[model samples]
Structures are given as structure tokens and as C-alpha cells.
Target: MLLKPGRGFFFAIVLSSVAPVAGATALAVDPMTVLIREYSRGNGSYEYLNSGTDESYARYILDRPSSPYANIKWSLLPSPDTPTRRAIESVSTQEHPVNLRDLHDMKVWDLGFTKAHIASETFRMPQELRYVPGAWSIVKAGIEPDIYAQAIRNQGLEHPAMTANYALAAQLLRAKLAATPPSLWKIRGLRHDVLDRFVGGEFMLAHDFHYLIQFLDGALATWDAGSTSAYGFRQLPAPLRLGRIAAAYRQRLPFEHEPCMEDDTHDPEHAGEGTFDRRPLCFDDATDRAIHVWYAHELVQELAAIHDRANGAPTLAERMAAPLRSSRQGWIGIPRPSAIAEVTRIEVVEAKVTGQLLVEGDVSYRDAFGASRRALRLSCGMRP
Candidate 1:
């Protein structure tokens, strides 16, 4: 039942749903793109960049600017080697545009690349390992088996790449669960360390993830999707209201809107066309302090911009090499998002496709300079 190269509804591919739990290579078509789509359209992975799509360029090495919890991992990674980063910035030779293919030398993990090779054969080698929020989201969702068996209860609505991260993480965990045991989650090591990283954090919506897992697990216990037997399922976590989180941060930052709302969505009808205009906006409260809170849609756009710029290569590198002289404002290099859409249609196509993902009912944060949030769609394809 695993999706074949030319079968199944495009992005509707899910591991456990595709077939009986027999093996990790259950599906014929790779599940990389499908997993990214789950985290909202904004996220792209290391696998994606190396992909043939023109959108599969460099910059989004870690596209978590929209997610509040993204920076934790980015900051933890070794800073892009200053000399190498400087060389990349210097850009003496523009022969190679530094696409994913050009990143073979990036074997060691840096702020912009994964430590594991992109083409490594290890099952542990992930297609997309750059985004922390997405990675943590997937790991959290897969903490227990039943959590995934009863998946309907989990409406992974927020965090730019969080849901996508959950999808990939869940898939790998499923593979692990197939041969190993659910108790592996309890054992100490990579899995347990990841659990502690996210769950231990008091403010990264840890309880939301916990309740989501519990709710899904409980729902699975019952056959009906509408009804649940456990009391824990009845007490679901409150919705992820984008406005309130923004308002709380607004209190500290100098957003055009004062004392931003505690709970609200984007108003596509009347919104500014800038990075700060989105729900999961990031701005430093004070110097050297950056805070990012990503909405489901905002991160989608944020990730695209990051990738496009990185793909552009040496041109961007030269700009990065430019020094900041006097009155300093952090370099705001987010390119205009390619697709400000309403609906996204994911397909595994040739490299010609790469655009922003659009989610319906969710407000479009950018202005209508050349943007419209109509029945819009973007596709991230892979050429195999």
C-alpha cells in the first residue's frame, strides 16, 4: 500500500496508512515531500535542497525563524566556520552556484548544513535535518506508538515546519517501532535526549504536544473518531491562537501594532507586505536578543525565501560579506516569498516546481503588491 512512483493522492501519503506495518521501505515513492507538506507548506529539508527543483537551493539550511523554539538548535550548532563562511562570502569563483550538490564539502554539521551527508545510505540519515522545530515536532509526536495510530485527534496547526518535522520523525519512529519496541522511547540516548530537549522546555508548548499525543492515543482506543473513552482525550489542549503569542511578544518589541492581540489570525484583506507582517514574526526585544514565533503559514513563506536566497549563491554571498558599519540594524535578507497562496497542491514532479504554500482560512500576512491569497497552490517536487 505504500505509494508507488505514479500512484496515490499526491500529498495524501502517510506511512502507517499506506500499508500494513511490515517494513520501513513500505512505500515505493519516497515519503520525503509528503512529510514536509505536513508541517504546513513553509518548511523544506536538506533532502529537498539536494532535489532537482529550482527551489532546492541553499539558504534555508535551517528555516525556523518563524517558530519560537527554532533558535535553540540553530544557536547550538557550530557557527558556520568563520574562514569557510568568509570564503563563501568572498566568492572568488562563481563557477559553482553552491547548490545542494555543491555542498558535499559541507560534511561536518554547521549552522547551515547537517553533519550527516545528504546522500548517505544510513536510515538515520534524514533528507531534511536543518529545521529544529520540525525535527522536535516529529520526535514529540512519535514519543509513543498509539499516539500515531490514532492520528485524527492531532491537528498539527502551528509551527512553520513543526508538522512536517513531525511527519518525518514519525515515519522514522514507525520504522524503529516496527522492529524495536515502544519502550525505546524510554531508553536513554538520541531519542530520549530529543524528548528531554523539547518536553523539558516549559514554554515551547510542551504540554500541547503531550496532550496531543495522549488525545490521539486515547482516540485510537475507541473505534469512532468523534468519540473518545479516556478523560484525558476529553481535555484537549487549547487551540494554538497566533494572535495572543504575537501580542505577548509585541509587549516587548516595537511592532507597528501596539499591545498586539492575544488571539487572532492574519487579515489578508488589510495587511502589510513584510516579514514582520506575519503571525509568527521575529524581532529582537533588545540588542542580540531575537525571538521568533511561527504560525503555520508564516513559516511556509519564511522557509521559501530562505531557500531561494541560498540557491542564488555567490551573489548572496557577496552581500553577506558586506560589513555593517555605523548605526546598526540586523541584516534583514528575507527575499519576497514566491507564493502567497491559499491552497497548496503537493506533487512529486521534476525540478521545475518550487513555490510558497498557501493555507485556506488562514490570513495572508503580506500585502497585495503582486500577491493574492486566492485559491493559490505551490508544489515542491523531487526528481528520482
Candidate 2:
């Protein structure tokens, strides 16, 4: 699903609802601009740069209604070989001045342009129209299974690394559950090293394990907060409040007596060298960390369901079907596409059309003054 085209490649998204209108010609559109077109009307914002930074450009056309650059149509990715494309790409010898195309290679803000001129700068989406946050607030906006399911369905494909990490986590979870004297968790520093044998080379690949620690830290803090906290564990039935188990899992995740930085398993030079500082789980592996987090998250939900079964509380599967949301943080990212489309047919057409869609991205480009470059992060979508 990851598309990589030449410098100015076309990305077309055809949804089932708009399939008839889009016709056979898959609209060659920049996903980000499509989002801005859908939601950046009254939601856009504008802020001027510091003094001496294109006062004329800011004063004249920035927010003015008559300015074409301020218009969403003007902000779109111009069709190939068109006058608009030619004009925008003319001054710069580099890739098309399409917004956000140079994101990864952006220059630091402190280092201003080597040469400065108005014509020297390239055309990109203006800052005002690229501030769409509404797109992110939707997937979880509706009720259960609303947009959240669609997101995971679209974006949740697993790679080999992810699969291996999840397998490791599953093995560890199984071993932990089978350990003798389950009440050992009541003793804070007890070792649950049943699956420590798996903590070797392959385990080190999960670089994002710290996020699991972070989630555990939040769980502990919430539990400690008691009834006063908005997400207080005390609000839950006593059986569902897994405070001690979480603490034990946190303690057992790393070497209890060792410092994280000095842990040799995570250190490149000393990794898997059998150093005393080596941990059962390296806190830095991204895939491994995500598996651990997913494991722990689902474990807690299952435990809660088991405990609350008698009281007719929602089961783990029921909760899993619900959209991703939080009382404290509101909507969260879950569903993949956020906007869905069905491809009815494939045939070449010539006209441009906007279809229901959602795409979020960050674009880095130098300002019109050719001064410092900055990033524009936005979430754009047209919900079905």
C-alpha cells in the first residue's frame, strides 16, 4: 500500500460512494491537499513570521479572499504538464514545489538559506491552510466500531519483525501465567524469569519497549491516584483493579537492580554478551516493545472482563469492538484510512474530482523568504 512514485507522482484514492463520479480516471490528487479542501475552510489559521520575513507577502495575499494562493484549489497538487505545475516548478531546479515533498531532507531552522530572493523560493501549501487537526479527531468520534475498525483493517498489516516480536511476547505471557506460586506477585521483588530464555538476540529488536514502561508507569500512577483521579483505579470494582499485578509486571520487565542505561542487553557493543547488566527485555526495541504493550493491554482487558463477568460488565471482545477513545484525551488514532473508498472500475479519465478521503502528513519546506525551513503537520480527511 506504500506508494513511491517519481518526483511528482500521482496518488489516487477512489472510494465506492464516489466511484461513479470519479469514473474511470482515478483522480491524481495529493492526499493532504484533498483533506485541506474538505476541512480547512473556517478551520484554517494564520500567524505572521517575525519581522523582516516577507512583510509584503504576508500583508498582501496570505489571508486575503481574492488571493489564489489562499484558495484550496490553488493549494492542490497541479496536474502534470499543466501551466500551474510548470509555473510552480519553474524557478526551482529541484523536485516539484509540491507541499511536504521534501519533508525528510528539510534543513534546520537555525540555518537560513544560503541565498535569498523572492523568485528563489518555491510554491508550497501555505501555512494557514495546512493546520487541519479535525481529521485526527474523527476515527474515534462516532460510536462503537464507527471509524476505528476501518482504520485498523486498513493499517494493521504485520511484518516479519512484528510477528516475531509478538510470538516472543505470547510465549512470555504463557510462561508467566503457568508459573508456580502465582501469589508470588504479592512479594514486590519476586522474579518471574520463567521465559528469560527467550531474551536473547531476536528480543533486542524491539526498540520501543520504553513505551510499555511508560504505559505501566501511567497505570501505577493512576492506581496510586485512588478515587480522586478522573481515571482512578478505585472507580473500578476491586476485582478489576489489577494494581499489584501491573506493578509486578513492571518490576519483572527489566533487571530490578540494574540501571536502564547501563543494561548491556540494550547496549550495542555489549549486547547479548552475557553481561550481568543484561535485561530479560531490552527497553529499546520498537517491535518488541509494541508487542509487549499490546500483550499487556489485552491482558488487562481480559482480566477486567473475567473479574466483572458476574456483574454483567462488558467482556473483552465487546470492548475490543468499541472505538478507541479516552475520557481524558478525547479521540485517539486507530482506524487506518479514516476515509474509505471502493474501486468500482479502472479506466483513464481527464477531469479532476475530489472524493471522500482522509490522509495526515508532515511537510517541511523553506518559507517564501528562503529563510528558515519549517514543518507543516496536518490531518486531512473527507469522511464517508
Candidate 3:
């Protein structure tokens, strides 16, 4: 994902300073302090396991309740598979292989497939046909008087995994958009394609868009409340909200520019005679609209929610500066970023040992996108 050059630089500064010493404070007084400390320790454990040679040792350490490393080990468990293996298996073996064409032929409001075996297959359908597949196929197949009469009865059934895939794809997209920054260049095109597909009557893709919009609405509501509390505002401006929504959209889609070559030998059962296209979906005309659209919207909404919540209280700037006051000298500590970059200097702006610590810093970097842009600046402070 492309992040705006300025924001990326700012993020680098915050990460370097606030991120490093984020958990240094004792948790007895500050809840966030304690949470950070615990999380850090836990994160370290998983990092060790992931990078270490012994998987069994990692599992053993995680299994021990009283182990000092327990939290990390437990937290490090890999995310559960998005689509349950059982569900996928059920759909794959179902009597009828529900393909994209099937979904495009079903009736709108026909919820029978919700319990069907090929739930995941529903995701392959086009957007306009999402709710009323039968109507769509009739129109596309042409209204021959005789053929049209039986269209409703002949509508194809979709597999349960189709529904499951659509749901999962929507979820994954939301997460990506939320975690990524706005300057990521690919997001705009991705978002545009997602919206276009939905409005253009691509029903399967529209299902994804609908899901994304719903998710965004929920996230935005939470963010708005947070903003109201922190900034003393009744509501966020419409433009800001929309911008946030867009940002969230971009964040969810993964960096799929890298080519993916599939090896059928890895999964012999699913492998076929010809070479398969294993490439991750890139936002393009040829991309699968259902999957991509769902993902993009879901991601943007999530990111917007996060930014709204985080930006609500003691803005990042203010938070980063809290460690610098003279009175809080004893409580002052380093700031940490989520990631690291080249650092030039760290400064204490304010502090009150009896109160909180504020700190700031400067950082420099050539853009991650390799534009050769250099010497960016950022500031952050933490209070405890």
C-alpha cells in the first residue's frame, strides 16, 4: 500500500521514538502502560518462536500456564483459517459444483443457499445478480419466449462456500485498509474499481460493496463517538468522514503486485492438467470483482474506525510531547513507532514527574516507494 510521503515520514518519527519505550512505565497506575507492557512481552515471545528453529519448543513454552513466556506463546498462535476447511470440503464435494454462472442464475431474496453445501460458491456470482440471480441470467441469456418461461424454475443453486468466501473476503479487505496508510498509491485505483463494479450492476461485486459499506458505517460510528469525546465535537464533518472511509478502503487490499505462480503438485487433489494462475488479485479490469470489491471496502472502513478512535484523545502530536516536561522527568521515557526508520534526534518537550511525560523527535528517510525523496520530519510524545 502507498502511504502519503508526509504521513509516512511522520509515522516513522512516532514509531522510532514513542514505540520503543512505550511499555517502560509501570502498569500499577496507568492501564495503557500495563497493557503495553504485557503486549510487548507477549509479542516478544511470539517473535522468538516465529524466528526460532524449534516449533515444538515454542508450543511447549506456550502450553505452560505459569511460564514467564506463556503470554507470548499463546498470543502467537497463527490466525485460524478464514474459510473453515470443513466448509470448503463440503462445498467442493457437493453434487453440483456451484460456479460463477450458477450464482448469476439464482433468484434474489432466495435464501435457500444459506444452508446449502456450496456456500462459498456464492462469492463467484456477479454483483447485480447477488440478491436475484434468476432475473439477471434471464436478461443476459436473452428473453426467448419459451426459455424465459422456465427461467425462474431453472435457476441454479449456489454452494455455501460462496457465501462464506464473500464474507471472508469482505473481512480481509476491511482489515487491510485499516492497517495501511493513505499515501499508498494502489488504493485509489482499487477503491475506484470496487465502487464502479457495484454501481455498474456487477451483483457479486456489489455484495462485497454492500458488506464493506455496512462495516464502514459501524466503524465510522465508533470513530465519531471517539472524536466527539476527544475533540469536543458533536460530529465529524462529512468530508472528513468520507475521506476516512476511502482511506479505510485502500488499507484492506494487500500488495499483490508481486507475481504468484501456483504449483498444482502442492495440492494434487485440486491440481489440473494445465498450469493455473496463482497470482493474487491486482486491481484491474481482469480482476475478480467479487473478491476485490468486498476486500477493498471492508479494509477502508476498519482503518477509518481505528484512526477515528486513536485521533480522538490527546492527538498523536500531543501524546508524543507529554514526556518532556521537567516535573515529570522521572516518568519520561522513549517513544516507539510500530516500525523503525533512520533517526536523527530525540528531544524532551515537557514533563512533570508528578504527572506525565512529553517528548518529541526528528527522523529522516528516503521514501519506502523509492522515489528518492529524503529528509522528512515527525514528532510524537507519550504521557504516563
Among the numbered candidates, top lDDT falls to: 1
* Candidate 1 global TM-score: 0.21
Kindly report which residue stretches of model 3 are placed more than 4 angstroms away from their true locations once superposed.
1-58, 61-163, 174-188, 192-202, 205-384
**Local accuracy of candidate 3 as per-residue lDDT tens digits, 1-384:** 010111111121111100011111101122111212232233321221122212232232223322211211112222212222222233332444422212111210010001010122222433443443122222211122222222112211121111222222233243345556746627432243443332243433323434544443333222111111011111121112232222222323343342222320113232111212333221111111112222333322222232223545543222212221111111211132210111111111001110121111111111111111111222233211
| lDDT of each candidate versus the true structure | 0.24, 0.22, 0.22
- Model 3 poorest ten-residue lDDT run: 108-117
Q: What digit string (tens of lDDT, one per residue) describes model 2 on residues 1-384?
A: 001122233332322111011111111223323222322222220111211222222222123322211211111222433322332233233433432322101110001110000111222323432232211111111111211222223212122112222222323233334564668643632233422322331232122232222232233222111121111101211111221112222323334443223321234332221212223222221111112232333333332332224467554333322211221111211231111010100000000111111112211121211111111111133211
Please provide, for model 1 over 263-331, each residue's C-alpha lDDT reduced to its tens digit, 9 standing for 90 to 100: 222233332323355443322110001111223234334333332244544332122112210001112
Best by TM-score: 1
- Our tally of clashes for model 3 stands at 73
Candidate with more favorable, higher lDDT: 2 or 3:
3
The regions of model 2 sitting more than 4 angstroms off are: 1-281, 285-305, 309-384
Each model's Cα RMSD: 22.9, 24.3, 23.7
Give the worst 10-residue stretch by lDDT in candidate 1. Answer: 324-333
